[model samples]
Target: MAKYANGHLPARDRFAHWRELLSGTHAPMTLSSERADDFLARQHVVALGEVTVWPAVFPPVTFRRTRELIRRSDPESYHLTLMLRGSGIADWRHRTLRTSPGTFHTSDSSRPVEIRSWAERGRIMMIGVEVPKAVLPLPRRLADRAVGLPVPDDQGVGALLSHTLRRLVRDLPEYRLADGPRLGEVVAGLTATVLGQVTDGESALPPHVHRETTALRVRAFVEQHLGDPDLSPALIAAAHHISTSYLHRVFRAEDVTVGTLIRQRRLRRARAELADPRWDGVPIQTIAARWCFTGAQFSRSFRTAYDMTPGEYRGLRGGDGPGV
Candidate 1:
């Protein structure tokens, strides 16, 4: 199993560790006496780290000093974070951020800002990307404000981006260096899209790329919720905070219907079970029910999608399997 260290490390040491990683240099952070270690975990994905922390342990401790730390970190090189696990208040310029579950705050390293996590232990997950400023494509002022601010979780680009980030952190191995630049683009695009900052007259996006991103997200969502029989078009749409019509549009653009996609996915899973000899004795009806095919209708639907009945497929495998 992957090892993880959970606890605090002194702030100066933590700062120096991150600085060395980001700068690719040997300079160490200067600290008189600062302690800030909440929890740190080695990310499952390469080129990234997963950290959960509360504001009380943040570097510099004081708001003014924390601002200086941000400046030293070089936001252009690392994307700092504000994620909340518990209810808390964040004080950012002109904005009093109420950090609730699902709150996400990102800031550029160069900017100076004060953020306070609410009284309750507010938790955050930070994934820093080593990217240059030239590629960010946003004005400094806008970027500063946009960072450390809440982006609505209610769908459109934001939900997709949030889902992608969560999945990336959860399934990091699937990404590669070749994917880094493109991932950065998606990150910037979604950030801009959610912030309503995408300018007019920009070149049209490639339909294939657009379709691929959404399709990947749809597939990921399906895979993640396989056990939920109610994961239908309406539910999927709701999950993404998109209207059913818009969800259908996404499917239609990919040359499929929402219902068709779901059934195909269910049948494909059912077929694998029916074919696997290990499940031979686990009654065919039970196997069907396990995949959400609870009745004759589902059984018929499965047969129509795949040529063999579930029982026939299981029977052909022999009775060696006793349970799922």
Candidate 2:
């Protein structure tokens, strides 16, 4: 989620700003607060393709998910929120939970709930994960057990999950647009691991399934960081805590090397950008720099792959370019 600087809104527009931002980020609902006139909030959003990790700070407010809201809207995915600062009291699924920093909780958009939040000193801070129910690798009944339940950050699976989410947010600078979907897979897998444990140990994914799932996570991480320029077999392996040899071996099974895929993806992105009218004002050198390519190298590689200079290709508007 990108940051919505509500503090910048005018007094007359503060309510509208906050209202739109909250509803857009989470589920559709109503917001109320005596201090709406002075509400201050912002968020950093990490969209991992299917999973979305959102960290936000807000002033005191009441967010309600009413029966009418539920009835009128299509069901959204489940959300897991870990409070980093401030606190909240939630009424959901016939239970009330006092949420504080170092505590996490789950909620279903399909259900009716009320959350009254209070600031710690002067602000409320939290991290939220949105996971589609269909992607979770668990039975529906077992997954339902987690909704509305508070899991402490230092205990059980919550500890690992909370830690992972924080790390992901902190490392946002290292991620790219392609990484969103891969990270989404990682979030879903971690969530499934936690939810699976909550129901019963035996209910967790089988060992083989777990390995396959983890492999997908590793691949996603690599793809997400592919544009780093420093991205290499060793770097990719180190980031995921795996051996370089293992990385090579695994990618071999896919019939392509990591380096080859990175080069191809970079070229594809560059080609797509060059062909699009939106990048028409962007200079060829500027575009090359972004993808870690120099003027000569980018020209040579692109011509070999697509048979045209970057500028010539751009001029063609993606049709009937130079062939000789």
Candidate 3:
């Protein structure tokens, strides 16, 4: 019999092939079951019908059903089960998990495991993300040790990733064709984050991956407009298709500010020119203008920052200084 009686297939196809396969109509259940099996195989578990994901402080899942799922699916993915309702017990080769609300349990797909729910009858939310065995960074020797480790939902990168995933699932259908690439990236990042947590920081899965992926674009935009005297927050934001507030937020996260960082960089370049003996009498205004600085204002900020006026600092450095 199919475990998922309500959600496994669309309601319209409830009476046709889907229901027939669940009833075990065909022999060996191999050929006829291939479709359902293939679909289930993609994920680590399956049900004869639909599975309702509820939002309680904690989540719940059927222990017996969970065991059946493990035995039947035997996949290569990872499962993170968060108990939200009542309670439950997870039995593995040698350990037992007494699950409660707000607590989580993890398991690998290649093992034999059992999950038993508490007597009160509870429900839980299960998050599943697949990682190929061959690509797992940690040695098998230590991989299993992380199983059943409770993921605290309060803080840290894990919490951030968990929150993002929960929000994504809640708005799953909104991810359509136009958003496929972004959705895929989000999925990859979230999966990496979970893996890193499971492996105890042995993985390089963090939000920085996304940041780096787009860093080149940011750098290019800033460089191309290096000569704009008004190359300020509003200009940068408009060029990058983001809000000025968001641009500032990104710079702040990097331990700098949009305007301050740009000004510092510009001053550094200007100082290099001032030190060049070739431009010995280039005029302070000329040097500042060459670097896209606002003449007098640049000199003021530069002096305030470096503790000396531009010309004075220039003469002290004796030309031939830094480069591009």
Candidate 4:
């Protein structure tokens, strides 16, 4: 991971420095900002193989890639932007899109595009990923349809992709440089999945990408319905319109069964609530039920996992009092 900041630079050189950095990190582009004279910005970049993830905050600015710039040098890649806290307008291929928080925008390096963004209150914050077009598993024609399109990141595959990007950025510090290629594969796979969903091109993805995407979707579903007692492999399969056996096969690569994954997540959630002081007044059984665990079963599982019963663990964590 690499970090860049312009706060220490001379005020007159801040925006210019920012422009140069952007050109190197992303593709060559002309940047203009009304606050150029005193632009304040910081960027964190993570290079995962051929794919690069950049999380940045900067003053309101307009970035444009002209035809001449494309002619001079084009990475032949697609740039995806996930807006975290900002509003922006993008113009590409004669199409215009207005984007806000929790939305996504895409542009092609081989094409001319213009994006003007402004902050809601503070600096505009967003995460951008540069994906080589050839690296995506989707067909060229289908993937091209997603370029210059603005989509919401709050639903379906988009939500999963958004979560993955944010988690990667947040946990980058914990990853070793040697993990780049593997991490790159994950990001690229999700990018393909998102583009496939957007362009109705899922049928074209390779088997491996399909399996990984399905597993990701299943994990997301499990997280959403963890509190439901009826959550099981059969229900999960039915929700995704796949057979139970197929669901098992999807998770085989993960080295854990679906049932185990659900149980582990539930136990983790229960443990967190038990240790939180705010839940001190809540009965242990009630807390257990909240996470779909019965009283006896909860105690046994908690003891097995943490080597302590729920009451003991709670007391050790400074809860108000222990519970049976």
**Candidate with best TM-score:** 4
Candidate 3 residues 174-230, lDDT tens each? 655456445445444444455556677544434465453234345545665767777
Error of 2 at 220 (Å): 18
Cα deviation at 42, candidate 4, in Å, is: 0.9
Per-residue CA lDDT of model 2 for 256-302, tens digit only, reads: 78787777778887888787777777787777767888888899989
Give lDDT tens digits, candidate 1, residues 1-324.
Answer: 122323355533564443333233211223221234432322222332222111222222223225556545543532433242434444555566665545455544465444443323333334333334454444444555565567555455556666656665665456675665566566655544444332321223344444555665677688767768788988887876668887777887778897777777877787787787676667766776777877586668866876766665566756445432
CA lDDT of 121 in candidate 4?
91
User: What is candidate 2's TM-score against the reference?
Assistant: 0.64
Give the C-alpha lDDT of model 4: 0.90
TM-scores of the candidates in the order shown = 0.54, 0.64, 0.42, 0.94
Candidate 1 lDDT score relative to the true structure: 0.51
Point out the worst 10-residue segment of candidate 1 by lDDT.
49-58
User: How far off is residue 102 in model 1, in Å?
Assistant: 1.8
Candidate 4 RMSD to the correct structure = 1.7
Error of model 3, residue 324, in angstroms? 45
- Candidate with the larger lDDT of 3 and 4: 4
TM-score pick, better of 2 and 4: 4
Q: Write the per-residue lDDT of candidate 4 for residues 1-324, one digit (tens) a residue.
A: 889999999999999999999998889999998898899999998999999999999989999999999999898988889999989899985788898887788888988989999885968999999989989778888789888676679988888889988999988879999999888888888888888888888888999998998999999999999999999999999999999999999899989999999999999999998888888999999999999989999999999988999999899867875497
Cα error, candidate 4, residue 71 (Å) = 2.4
Residue 222 shift from truth in candidate 3, angstroms:
22
